[model samples]
Target: MAATIRFLTARGVPVMAHVGLTPQAVNTFGGYRVQGLGDDAERIRRDAGAVTEAGAFSVVLEKVPEPLARAITAEIAIPTIGIGASPACDGQILVVDDVLGMFTEFRPKFVKRYAELGSEAEAAIGAYADDVRERRFPAAEHVYATASKAGDVA
Candidate 1:
């Protein structure tokens, strides 16, 4: 991972490392649960340190204890972006779907939905389906005249 980070940074490509509750490792972690608790905190700390040392411009600390996140943020030279972590982080981020309430499968504890776009989208789709079933769609304005009907054929 450090090699990859170094390679990217060496080429002037900015790298942001994600640690603690990495979504890609969800299955290995047994689910989307908070990481870096108790002894595990040390591992997260080391991961952040390694990434920073390897030239990461920033790191995301996700779903870890507040104190741990804060500690890592202070310890690291690069900025710390928090997701379900401490407010003390240099910046914060949340999944766009979660913010818009478009994803209903699972809601994480840290997600605070600002809008229920999923429900609105469902209602819209239902309305469109009803229109189609009732033959209300494909009204006169919806169809285009063929060349013969438009008297364009020689």
Candidate 2:
């Protein structure tokens, strides 16, 4: 991972390192569970430091304990972006779908939904389906007249 970070940074490509509950490794982790707990905290800390040393401009501390995130943020030279980590981080982020409440499959403990757009969208789609079934959608205004029907021919 450090080699990859170095390779990207050396080529002037900005790298943002993500440690603790990396989503791509969800299967390896068994699930979207909190990381940096007990013995694993040291590993996360080391990973953050390694990325920073390898020239990562920022690192995302995801689904780790607040204290661990805070400690890593203080120890690392790069900015720490938090997701499910605490306010102690340099910045915070949440998935846009989660914020809009559009993803109903799974809700994480840290997600604070700002709107219930999914339900509203479902309701709107249902209304449209009803309109189609009642033949109300193709009202006269929706029909287009062809040029030949209007007596124009080339």
Candidate 3:
């Protein structure tokens, strides 16, 4: 991770480092849960230091204890972006689908839905399908005359 960050940042690419309860390592961590707890907090703190040392401008602190997040934020020179971590972070991020209620297969506890767009979309699609089935759509103004006609009836 640090190597990639160093390579990218050296090339003028701004990099954001991710640590604490990484989704890709969910299987290894025994599923999605809070990281940087108890003695492991120090490990997470060290990881954050390494990330910043690698030239990353920001680090994502995900599913970490609030105190640990605070410690890392204080220790690291770079900004900390939290997800499932608390207000101690410099910034916050959430999946767009989770925030908009578009993906509901499995809702995490941290996710706060701002709108039920999925249900709205389902209802709108149903209405559209019904309109098409009942021939309520494509009314007179929706169509145009054939090349053989000049504003005449079909």
Candidate 4:
């Protein structure tokens, strides 16, 4: 916490430390499942306390028990950004692709699909290719000549 805060404060970037179901710990955490359930809640509380005490500007509690997350948020002076945690957080962030329906194989309930940029981009490229084949692009003055134009050599 202190180290995170110190670094962020010095660099002028907001701090967001992750705990509970951090992807880096996915194997130990048993996949991307929620954490802080059952007996683990207390441990989470302690961890959150330690983080807050250390002076972290903010924390990201991913895939944690909602109740425990809420409690941690209430206890901490700094903000908590819940990726898969709770609604009680100060703010939330989502990957544009996932929320926009780009990743259809996996989806979290909390994520709200914003757009379908994947499909949009694909269609745009297809249209551009078609235009190129039909000589729709590089019209007249759009391209340069190998040699100077009729009046250029003068």
| Steric clash pairs (candidate 2) | none
Model 3: per-residue lDDT, tens digit, 22-117? Answer: 999999988888888888888899889998999999999999988999988998999999998999999999999888998668888778899879
CA lDDT scores, all candidates in order:
0.93, 0.93, 0.90, 0.77
The alpha-carbon deviation from the true structure for residue 119 of candidate 3, after best TM-score superposition, in angstroms, is 1.4
Rank the candidate models, highest lDDT first: 2, 1, 3, 4
lDDT for predicted candidate 1 compared with the true structure: 0.93
CA-RMSD of model 2: 5.1
- For every model in order, what is the number of clashing pairs? 0, 0, 0, 1
Q: Which regions of candidate 3 deviate over 4 angstroms? A: 125-154
How does residue 133 of candidate 4 score in lDDT? 100
In model 4, which regions exceed 4 Å deviation?
1-14, 121-154
How high is each candidate's TM-score?
0.83, 0.83, 0.78, 0.68
Q: Which residue pairs collide in model 3, if any?
A: none
lDDT for residue 27 in candidate 4, whole number 0-100: 89
Q: Which of candidates 2 and 3 reaches a greater lDDT? A: 2
TM-score (C-alpha) between model 1 and the true structure: 0.83
Error of 4 at 39 (Å): 1.1
- lDDT by residue (1-154, candidate 1, tens digit) is 7889999999999999999999998999988899998999999999999999999999999999999999998999999999999798999999999999997888999999999899898899999999999999989777666535566544
Q: Which of the numbered candidates is closest to the native, going by highest lDDT?
A: 2
